[model samples]
Target: MPCCRLLWRPQRPNEDFRMNKQDLSEDTEVVLLLCGRFGGEKQEPHQPLSPREYSELAKWLNACNLRPSDLMTDAGRDALSSLQVARLESKRVEFLLGRGTAMALALERWARGGLWVISRGDMDYPKRLKRQLKHAAPPLLYGAGDKTLLEKGGLAIIGSRDASESALSYTRSIAARCAHEGLAVVSGGARGVDAAAMQGATEAGGYCIGVLANDLLKTSVNRQNRIGLQEGCLVLVSPFFPEAGFSAGNAMGRNRYIYTLADQALVIDSALRSGGTWEGAVENLKNGWVPLYVRTPGEGPGNVALVADGGLPFTLTADSTDSLVDLFASRPVDDVQSGSDIVETQQLLLVPEAMVTAEAVTAEIPSEPVQEKSQPLVSPEALASSPAPQPATATEVLAPSEAHASGDAVGTVEEPAMAEQPAQLLSCLSLDMYADFSAKLASLLGGGALSEEDIATQLCIEKSQAKAWLKRASEAGLVDKLKKPVRYALGRQGSLC
Candidate 1:
């Protein structure tokens, strides 16, 4: 069953991540030069800057109202010469930017091989990356096939590369069920559980997303995947290069992408205290990327421990699970499960990099596993690509002080007088963020309705907050409130204008 491959550098693909210019937008080209490895040189003199380094540079750019693309221009070059950014030398920036030849060669090769790349700043970039992971989002992503499949959120089925046969069967069944329900089944595209899951879904003629840790070039052209790729039913993406090899660090880093990309994550199996599965699940819990579910009858110690750590325990039997949509049905955020309850939820919003504080990039994350991370959570403007439109009349927001009474709808609690509320609780939200947030939220619902749980999960906000946002969106006529299951769908567009 061709399980997930282990850490081994392939001798071929001949040349990997040799980037290029021309086809790429200036922004992406600049990003690649600054952060990408141009696939040559045993010991290159000017190593690319890291994400944290790029972030620090971004802050300076935003401060000066300059973009990365601007750096290539004479005016931007003058600003670089005249301005002093801490810890960054003008020469260092120049050296990185000088790799135009390497960039062009790499891109040309990658493109010829049917690979494409997108920068975080691109509107086509997955909104989930911007909203869920925020600045932790990768600067560049390389992939093969349709990029739109990346946004069609579905369950992220993750497990050990060495999962047992029974667990593999379960993963396959679940993936197939998701396919039958018209939901995309996302996985690491590794061997073992990952392989089984994708196989099941694609075999069932269902769409799937393969978020690979490495080996995209090989995977894209692999005989087993060629049919799916050709059918436009599969998308394989990587934060690393298309021709990059497997590294344990890359494996670990890739897990966050899987979790963030999905509506929810389900662990079919996991190793205890180690492996990419364990580390990724631990990180997801700390970050609350989404409500995770561990297989109920799994043998692995990691599965047990994860449930104890607050993962929802779920059981999916193939025949009984015809529809995956029910799995994401609405649930209250505050009325969370007591022990092991199933939850059906997912959603996310985009944040512009300029709003993130410079210090956040400098803060070190803990080395060991921790239940909760200290990083500030991305506020739940869920799904805004740009600022939401301000209506002629003022619309209310779900402030911290406003609490839900009960159920999914905004509970009938009387609003507290503005005078009585704590100053901090009523603090103003960035109007641009809110506007962008609403427009994005509208876009998300434009397809189908979503529950409070779905909104909360995607936006990375509390469920109560999702309920509040829905109520406000409903009032503004941006979204229509549906009863019975209590979901919100796109409202009249003309009404907003």
Candidate 2:
């Protein structure tokens, strides 16, 4: 088989055997070869193997006790076939041959670039991501600079690409304070808030990890960034091709890496309706990946909304780094694990379906149901027991003499029924005056699912008010309450409103 032939390749007399093995295992050369070849890099809107696919493949490899290089063997093909992953038969031989042709060039480029590649199986891969994201963690991480920096958890400073000067300044100040307390600052290495945070940490002579979405090669060698790299205080990493340009999807995908690598996350600024910053913050909140914080007296509606949603308010003047550190220390680490375990269990249950064609798997999943906002604002049971209202066309006013002559039944109505009329009347009133507030609430919910506490923080309203509005909207069929911890999402009518 192919594995036997590769094992017999002539080796140089002076070549170090340990170095050769290290190159194979630590650099993920075999997996990279497979990925470059039959993994379909030429496909439009290129993407690497999805987290689910990687997890499935990993499970198969473990079950068979085979290394990535073994995949070139006949036995490997047999093993892969047994797993019944979709499209395996059509691509097996081509994938193996492609790996053979690309392996040399890939190794050369990686060596020349001074890059280190970690696959999911590698010991040095970030355990935090695997623990938090589980099957959703990236299969490979391409990095430059010190790899050990990834293990040192720190604060993640995230915000908008167009953050205000005041927000940027606050990010810098907080990052520097984190540095003084011997903490690293993690960021996406984009412009605005990301840049400010990284610069602050490095300038303070502290470590930082820049999780870049693109331009990893260029950013690693920049004159400004080079000093920190040389000092072994900055590490730049990416899951995308080193030379690839920025992509909206990639930018969003990398946000999770930033949040996962850190113990906590701080949002400096975010737009109200939508933005990467807002989306990432909301996602982190839902996923419970880390402790989320938003700056107090925020720069925009998004920040305020996030704070209202349950994000802790972070005030630079009022809060000190030591206190922040103490707060983090006091929190139970197991709380995070508990949240991740529930999500992981849900994902694990879907692995079998995920092994089928992607399209088929997606087709099997049902969409979330939406509630209408114009519907009755009371329960069906209450509506059933209540009296029917007069028709709109019955506009003629009845005289008391006519009512008595006709033996009107109006006087027979009970006082209790009259008392219930006002509530029903109020429920029927037009909510147009609160349209702006409803729209803003919908925008926050639409960004991503949130809990009631999150809604309260995001709207800067009392918990009771937030609950009342949510209940009213829900009764009007405007939002949905998802699973445990009770996340909220915009219903169809709410999204339109």
Candidate 3:
């Protein structure tokens, strides 16, 4: 019934024609309806496609360079008659003509907030995803968490949902190390290893996210270490509706998303011919995306085969931070080394008039007690009548530029210093040209519009460092972060007055 809704958007214009076709055969009527019917029910239930419906679909598939096998059995055609063929072509036209009915449902969620769509061409879509799509590309993606994380390279760690104790320990270690190196770890949100990796990032004070196979809301039932998610330490996502339950097919489909979400995939441990995770690895290898196989003392020969076939070794104890740092440092330095426009912009951002007004409100005004009449000889009664002066806290409303300047002077310059850095150095940074990026930063902060590429270019900092800066700014009553390539913006609260 709901699937019918998916097909109805474009068919409204032909409703009269459909209504007039009372004499149409059952097979022709079904084909004209363009509904996917199960193969088993076709003959046994006396349901069949007209020869024409069958032939036209075959032609369409051939034209698309696909076989009839490309579509699901439910979508296949049984042979159709001559008249049915003409009707089938019209039905095919209707199927292809459908409007936004299916899309509208997905879009409604996004419009209501907490939903995002990542199509194939979006720059924020992970490049790794593009690599995997070459083999088994998804139609569309709906997810949560920092979208920019997709752009900032990270390592994917995955393993059995029913992992053993030793496997989990090793998985946790690798995940924590990756987080410490400022790399986000990606995994399917099953049990065991996935949970371990997410918790590891939380413990390490780093960001991590889970890609789920089931409807995110249903599978999140036993999400034990949810402290991380609640605290914005980790991201959780699923392609299905939040209420959808688990299915074997969906679980296998999840492997693609996990691999697609990362720059490299690290298989901690897996059995031969395990679901698509292994298949996904082979697919990834074919696509030239690197696969990292961890070497365990008891790992089977299959892992060795993987290693032999161009899969790289993921040495957990190696200089992970150095490797990640180098990766980040290798990013283009032009954003920082460019021209004078940035310099002027940085200076303007330092002390805009708005910031001055906010600061003035916080600055204390000295009180001048009314000049007492010449009754200085008055006793304790006069002293008791005097009002006591209340102590005021020192307040400062420095812009990002000012914060950088002061920060540089103190030699405690960390990423995104509020008002402390050399003007020249500050000029190199890029900022969003919002009417006000700091408006609601105090209440609903942490979502920014910066992509990983945008951040890489603007901050002229390593990916991890940019994330750290965003995290700090988010914590400090500054910005708001939205899921999916987590962009930052000002919070709903006014400011840190």
lDDT of 1 by residue, 17-117 (tens): 33222245568778888888769844777678877778788888989999888887777888988657666788888878877667666666676657788
Q: Write the per-residue lDDT of candidate 3 for residues 1-497, one digit (tens) a residue.
A: 12334344343444343221222232222332232222233233223343334456556655555433223233432222122434454344344323225333433333233435444334555666656554244423455445565555577776544454555566666666777778887766544556656545555677775676544432233233234444555565655444344455555556667766776677655433233344555555555554444342213212323443444444443223446445434543222223243233333323332433321111111121122111111112311322431111100100011111112233321233232212211111223421122322211222324554465465455777666666755563344455554565443211111
lDDT (C-alpha, whole model) for all candidates: 0.61, 0.57, 0.42
Reference-based lDDT, residue 66, model 3: 48
lDDT per residue as tens, model 2, 1-497: 45522532233223453221345562265555444322235662333445566567666677789876667667776776566665434255335434443445444455455566777678888898889888778777887778789988899988754554555667777877888888899988765677767766765678898887766655654555556666789887777666555566676678889999999988876654356676677778777788887665454445544554446655555245456677667665433333234233222222121232212110101111121111111113311322431111100110111001224343322112111111111111233434435656745654667789988898888898888877876664345556555766654211100
TM-score of every model?
0.63, 0.62, 0.43
Ranking by lDDT: 1, 2, 3
The true-versus-predicted C-alpha distance at residue 455 of model 2, in Å, is: 26
Measured by TM-score, the strongest candidate is 1
Estimate candidate 2's alpha-carbon lDDT, on a 0 to 1 scale.
0.57
TM-score of 1: 0.63
